[model samples]
Every structure is written in structure tokens, then in C-alpha cells.
Target: MTTVYIADTGVFVRCGGPDKSKFQRLRRALQQAGVSLRIPQRVYQELGGNPAADKYPSGDIPYADGFEDGWIVVAEELDYANPLVSTVMDEVRRFIANETDRDEDIIEKADTALVGLAAQVLDTGEADHVVLLTTDKPAGRAAEALLPQHGFSDSIEFRYVSVAYLESLTADEFW
Candidate 1:
């Protein structure tokens, strides 16, 4: 079964500078696994969104290189017409808001897009399964808790890509 891996911004940031061990480990693992991480378009923008991020050692070079090496790719646009996807996204938004204790308006669609895209992908038969890699606690729990209720049992999994998670990754993970 094909597994679609969707990653959030924290994954990139956690990799840090070009020479960091974490960055090298993630790069080697992905290259050896022949799997590129998918980032939502909004996440794509968020990664390079800050003009001030360049000053930090954890910034710049590495991310551009990750793209050049093909370890990062932007996910396709979501289809608004899918009812299951739409319903799931709305539910995720509420779940995220409740989980984070944030107001509804503070939770943007992009915050829920990783889960929505996964639902849409499965609903459209685009993939056999999905693994969401994120640092957002509320969003991760939202995906893990909700998708199965919509009848996508065992097809979706959320992985919290913390500072340590990708630091020791290997091709075995992809296999």
C-alpha cells in the first residue's frame, strides 16, 4: 500500500542549519528511502515566510538545499467539492480549536489542511494510507482521533515530528 507522508513546517525547522546532524540524518534517510516529504502550500509559504529568519544559524541554506535535493515538495491543491473532505475539515477545525483552546477564527484552514488533504486523498482513492508528520499537538491529535469515525479506519496515522523524531531517522522508517 502506498503511504502518503504529509509534513508540517516544524519538520524543516527542526532540521536546523545545513551542517547540523539532524539535517544530514533526515536528508540521508529520505534520499535512501526515495521518499519526498509533502508540505501544504501554506506550509511551503510559512517555511520561507519570514524574511528575518535568515539571521539565525538554524535558518537559510539547509531548507533551500532540501528543496534542491528533492526531499521537499508541495502538496496539490485541495478539492472543495469532496463532501467527506469538507465535513472532515470542519470537524478538524473545531477539534483543533477545542484542543488548543483557541477561538475558531484563530484556527485557519491550513491548520486543518494536513488532515483534510489526507481525508480527501483517501476519499478520492489517491492513496492507500496517510501518515501526517507534524509538531502541532492539537492538530496531530485531531487527525488521529477523528478520521476513523468517518470510516477511514486504520488508514490515517499522525506522527508527532518532534526534535528527536527525525533526528535519528533512517531508511528503515520508510520501508
Candidate 2:
């Protein structure tokens, strides 16, 4: 089955420094798997949009190199017109708000886009399973807890890509 691996910012930051071993590990893993990490537009923007982030050693080089190497990619535009996409996004918005105990209005579409794209991929038969690679506990739980209820049982997997998760990561991560 084709599995889509969705990555979040923390994964990149966890790599640390330009020559961090974690970076090589992740890159090698994806290369071996012949699968690239999919970043939500929000994540892409978050990685490259912050000047403060640039100060960090890992952030200094940015994630664009991964993009160039085909180890990372931006998910395609979410078809907002698709009812399933729109519906799931709304559900994610509500789910995140509830999970984070924040106001619904404060949750932006981009925040919901991760789950929405995952749903779109599943609903469209683009992927049989989704592996969410994120450090965001609330968001990961939201996907795992809610996606199955929507009939994607056992199809959505959330892999908490914590510092420890990647700290030991190597080209064999997916192996």
C-alpha cells in the first residue's frame, strides 16, 4: 500500500545544525524508502517564514535543501471544493480547538490543513495509510482519535516525531 508520510516542523528542527546526524538519517531513510516527507503549507511557511528560526543552527540552512533532494515536498493544494475535504477540515478545526482548549475562530485553516490533506489523500485513494510525523501532540492525537471514527479505521497512524524519535533515527528508520 502506498503510505503518505506527513511531516511537521519539529522534525526538521530536531535535526539541529547543518550537519546534524539526524538530518542525514532522515534523508537516507526517505531516499531508501523512495518516499518524500510531505509538509503542510503551514509547516512549509513556518519553516521558512521566520527570521528568528534562521538564527538556529539547523534553521540556518533552511529545509529547502531537502526539497531540492526530493526528500521533502509540499502537499498539493487542498481541494476546498471537495465536500470531504471541506468537511474534514472543519472537523479538524473543531477537533483542534477542543483538543487545545482554544477558541475555534483562533484555529486557522492552515492548522487544520494537515488532517484535511490526509483525509483528501485517503478519500481520493491516493494513499492506503497515512503516517503523521509531528511533534504536536494535540494534532497527532486529533488525527488518530478522530480519523478512525470517520471510517478510516486502522488507516491513520500518528508517529510522534519527538527529539528522541529522530535522535536515534537513521537510514533504517523506515526499514
Candidate 3:
């Protein structure tokens, strides 16, 4: 079964600066595993949209290198036109709001894009298994909880991308 690895902004942030060993280690591990990290468009925006993020050391991502090397890719735009995608996104929004005890309006598509993308990928049969690498616990939990009920049980995994997790990462994690 093919495993599609979906990455989020926090994964790159947790890698720290471009020169950090963790970043190199992550790059090496992915390359050795012969797999690329696919980021939802929202994650791509989050990585580049915040000027304040530049001030943090962890924000200095050499993502360009990953792109140029072909181990990182901006996934195709989420097909909201697909009913399955839209429905799953709506479900994720509701799930997150209820989980956080917030008004449904407070949760937006951007907040649930990760789960939406995962659902899209699954429903479209693009991946046999989907692994989400994210630090957003709520969104991660939402994906883990909802996708299974859609008949994806045991096919979805969420790995919280903590600094320590990245630091100790190996190609084995991808396999």
C-alpha cells in the first residue's frame, strides 16, 4: 500500500532554522526513504504568510531547498467542488468547534484544511494510507477521529510533529 505523507507548517517550524541539524536530518531521512512531504495549500500559506514567523529561529525554513530537491511538494489545490471534500471539511469544522467548546463559526476552512485534504486524498483513492504530520492537536484529532468512520479505519495516522520527534526521526518513520 502506498503511504502518502502530509506535512503541516509545524513540521517545518519544528525543524528549526535552515542550518539546524534537525532540518538536515529530516531532509536526509525523507530522501533516504524516497518519499516527499505533501503540504496542503493552507499550510504553504501559513509557512509564508506570517512576517512575524520570520523572527523566530525555527521559522527560517530552507523549504526552497526541499522543493528544488523534490522531496517537498505543494499538493494540488483541495477540490472543494467534490462533495466528499466539502462534506468532510464541514464535519471537521463541527468536530473541532465541539472539541474546543467554541462556536462553529469560529472554526474556518483554513483551520480544517488539513483534515479536508486528507479526506479528499482518501476519497479520491490517491493514497492507500495517509499519515498526517502536524502539531495542531485539534485538527490532528479531528482527522484521526472522523476519517475512520468514513471507512478509513487503520488507514489514517497522525504524528504530532514535536521538536524531539523531528530530532529523532529516521527513514523508518516514513515506512
Best by TM-score: 3
- Give stretches of model 2 more than 4 Å off: 49-61
Model 3 / residue 93 / CA error / Å: 1.4
In model 2, the worst 10-residue window by lDDT is 49-58
Off by over 4 Å in 3: 49-62
Q: If scored against the real structure, what TM-score would every candidate get?
A: 0.86, 0.85, 0.87
What are the runs in model 1 whose C-alpha is more than 4 Å off? Answer: 49-62
Residue-wise C-alpha lDDT for candidate 2, range 1-175, written one tens digit per residue? 7889898777787788448887887887788878888877677767764323432223434765787677787776788899878888888888888978899999866557888888889999999899988877777887888788778999999888877777776656554
**lDDT score at residue 95, model 1, on the 0-100 scale:** 97
Candidate 2 global CA lDDT score? 0.78
TM-score of model 3 relative to the true fold? 0.87
**Each prediction's Cα lDDT score?**
0.78, 0.78, 0.81
Clashing pairs for model 2 are: none
| Candidate 3, run of 10 with poorest lDDT | 49-58
lDDT digits (tens) for residues 22-131 of candidate 1:
87888898899999887776676677543334422133334777766778766666776888878888999999888888898889766788888889878888788898
* Residue 94 Cα positional deviation in candidate 2, in Å, after optimal superposition: 1.6
Per-residue CA lDDT of model 3 for 13-45, tens digit only, reads 888856899889989999999999988777766
